[model samples]
Target: MSFLTLLRRVAMTLLFILLPAASGWACTPVFVRGQASTLRLNVGQLTVPADARPGTPLYHKSFAWNRLSDGGEQWIRCADDPHGLSPLLLDSLLSGGVTRPTVYQTNLAGIGVRVSLRAIGGYGCFPDRPTPSPFSQRVDNPAALPRCGVETGLFPPDD
Candidate 1:
């Protein structure tokens, strides 16, 4: 066979053999801190369900930023599911977009609010490999962001 055809065959073989071993997914989590007299964080969109009640999980992708200003930290867990979020997704939510961590302003419920976001870390990358829990029993700084749960070596966050 010609050199070109032989190279093609080898490449294809490597891809098939490596793809499964290299393929892994993860969920990235972001920490959002809001600063405003009355800040409210809304992810995705606001939808009122018929079963809406006090103290119940809203069953929506949105989060409440109102408590952020009270020395509270909010976490946006990343996942392949619709309820999860990522830095790229947050960037797209802005009027233009943000490339790096910067203070941003947006209107919520007709009120101006300022906020900042950072990717704390990622988790659930290797389904087959046993990993540590993302949460810690003791958080040194409740306001500080948490690090990634799983150790992602040589692989980037796909999910």
Candidate 2:
């Protein structure tokens, strides 16, 4: 091969080595469990860019739940772009008129978070009897528990 051809091949090889040829991607499974009952649930997985920096805003189109044993799941998605955080608010309804919130964290790059659910309002009062409750019971808007805030100087694991 000629000298020019050899130098061109070497330059191309170095470019490929330095740049990532494939997209950087990461998937994490977020589990949301009800606080009022024994029913355990897993929220939909989050597929985010692996190199997502701070203050990156992403949207979750829709999140649905599947019936587990006796209880059902009610979920809501909330985002906070100012704080670089996004989490799903989950409520699990069980027999005997019990409801609780379960929060799932998706922005895994930041500091660890503590999630909780609180009752805002409900349609009907708690039942007096211990028999199976009636349908059509609804809870008013539930609020997402406050996050402890992100810790500075924290970075995600390199994979």
Model 1 per-residue lDDT tens digits across residues 39-155: 334445545455644322322222233333355434344444435533322233223323422222234321222233322333222122222222112222223332211111111
The global C-alpha lDDT for each of the candidates, from Candidate 1 onward, is: 0.35, 0.32
On TM-score, the candidate that comes out on top is 1
Lowest summed lDDT across 10 adjacent residues in model 1 is found at: 148-157
Error of 2 at 120 (Å): 20
Model 2, span 1-159: residue lDDT tens: 999999999999998976684333222423344444232323255455777664343331211122222243333323222222233322233323233111223355552222222222221232222112122323322223311111122233322
The TM-score of predicted model 1 comes to 0.25
Q: Against the hidden reference, what TM-scores do the models get?
A: 0.25, 0.17
